[model samples]
Structure formats: C-alpha cells, structure tokens
Target: MNVFGMGLPEMALIMVIALLVFGPKKLPEIGRSLGKAIRGFQDASKEFENQFKLEAQQIEQGLNTPTPSESEKIAPKEVATAEVATAESNNHATTSSQQS
Candidate 1:
C-alpha cells in the first residue's frame, strides 16, 4: 500500500528505524500520541471548515436579502408632506402678521 507517496517498503524501513530508535515499549506510546495528535488536528480542521462554511452562508444570505435604501430608512412620504404643509402655513401666518 502507498501512503503519502511512500510505498510499503519505505513505510517498513521507517517503522524499523523508529522501532530501533524508540524500542518496542516506547513505540506504542509514541504511536498512541501520534494518533491522538492526528485525530485532534483532523477535528480542529473540520471545526474550522464548518465555521467557515457557516459564516459564508450567513454572508450569502445577507447579500441575497434586501437592505433599506437611504429614502426607505427615512420617515414616510406622508409625514414629510405634513411637515412641509405646517412650515408653509407658519410662513403664511408670519407674512400675514407682518402686513397687519
């Protein structure tokens, strides 16, 4: 079998070297630690991918959904009309009083 582009022979050689260096007793502990590290890395990578996807989805939804323009965010037309009418009336009242 091939792993990381290394054939069985290459894998066997590395294992032999590691066993000789660490000895049989320490080898299992090292293997367990290596396995645990790999598992933890995989879990962290998956979590990061999931988080990235969730954020991307949120951004996509935000883009798809409509936002209010400047005019839409402002007060409605009816209120604006009423305010203008009141100002005009006040101007008229002022002019009438000035004439009197």
Candidate 2:
C-alpha cells in the first residue's frame, strides 16, 4: 500500500525506526494521541467548510434580490420635499392675506 507517496517497504522501514526510537510501550499512547489530533483537525476543517458555504449562500441570495434604481430611491424624498414646499407657500399666502 502507498501512503503519503511511500510504498509498503518504506512504510515498514519507518515503522521499524519509530518502534526502535520509541519503545513498544510508548507506541500505543503516541498512536492514540496522533489519531485524536487528526480527528480534531478533521472536525474543525468540516466546520469551517460548512460556515464558508453558508456565508457564500447568503451572499448569493443577497445578490439575487432586486435593488432599487437611483430614481426609485430618490422618489419618496422628492415627493416629501414637494409637499413641504407647497405647505410653506400656503402658510405665506395666509399670513400675507391676514396682514392686508
């Protein structure tokens, strides 16, 4: 079997060296810790991928929705300004008639 681009013989040699460097008693503990670390990394990577996908979906939805044009955005403000100007002119006419 090839693992990390190493053939079976290379794997066997590395395993033998590891066993020699760390005795049989310590090997199981080291393997267990290594397994746990890999599991944790996998879990974290999955969570990050999920969050990224969720954010991308939200952005895509936002982009899909319609946005107001410049004129549409300005319309309500223009109407309100026109109403205010009319009210002010009416008030001035009333005051001038009262004074006359």
Candidate 3:
C-alpha cells in the first residue's frame, strides 16, 4: 500500500524513527494531539468553504435581483425639470429685486 507516495517500508521506517525518538510512553499522546490538530484544521477549512459559498450565493442573488429605481417610485425626469424651473425662478426673482 502507498500513502502520500510512500510505500509500506518507508512508512515502517518513519514509524520506527518516531518510536525511537518519542518512546512508546509518549507516542500515543503525540498521536492524539496530532489527530486533534488535523481534525480542527479540517473543521476550520470546511467552515471557511461553507462561508465562502454562502457569500458567493448572496452576491449572485444580489446581482440577479433588480433594484427599485427612484424613477419607479417618483418621476425622476419630472422631478429634475421641476428643480431646474424652481432654480430659474429664484434667479429671476433675485435679479429683479437687485435692479429695483
């Protein structure tokens, strides 16, 4: 059997080295901690992936949905024209008062 491109013999050599370095007493503790760390990392990665997907979906939905325009609620062109007319009227009134 192969694991991470390493054959059984390579795996045995690695295990033997680890056992010699750590001794049998501490090997199980080290293994437990390593397993826990891997599990935590996997969990974090999955959570991040899920969050990214959710955000992407939200962005896609936002892009697909049409936003309500001011023109839909109120006549934008009319409102703009009204504003311009009011400004012109105010300028005329000011000019007349200044001449008088």
TM-score of each: 0.73, 0.71, 0.66
Clashing pairs in 1: none
Judged by lDDT against the true structure, how good is candidate 2? 0.97
Which candidate achieves the best TM-score against the true structure?
1
Per residue, candidate 1 scores C-alpha lDDT tens digits across 1-100 of 8889999999999999999999999999999999999999999999999999999999999999999988786758868899999999999999999999
lDDT at 84, model 1: 97
Report residue 4 deviation for candidate 2 (angstroms): 1.4
The per-model lDDT (C-alpha) reads: 0.96, 0.97, 0.96
Mark the 10 consecutive residues where model 1 has the least summed lDDT.
70-79
Model 1: how far residue 12 lies from native, Å: 0.6
Q: Is candidate 1 or candidate 3 better by TM-score?
A: 1
- lDDT for model 3: 0.96
Candidate 2: stretches off by over 4 Å = 76-100
| Position 15, candidate 3: lDDT | 92
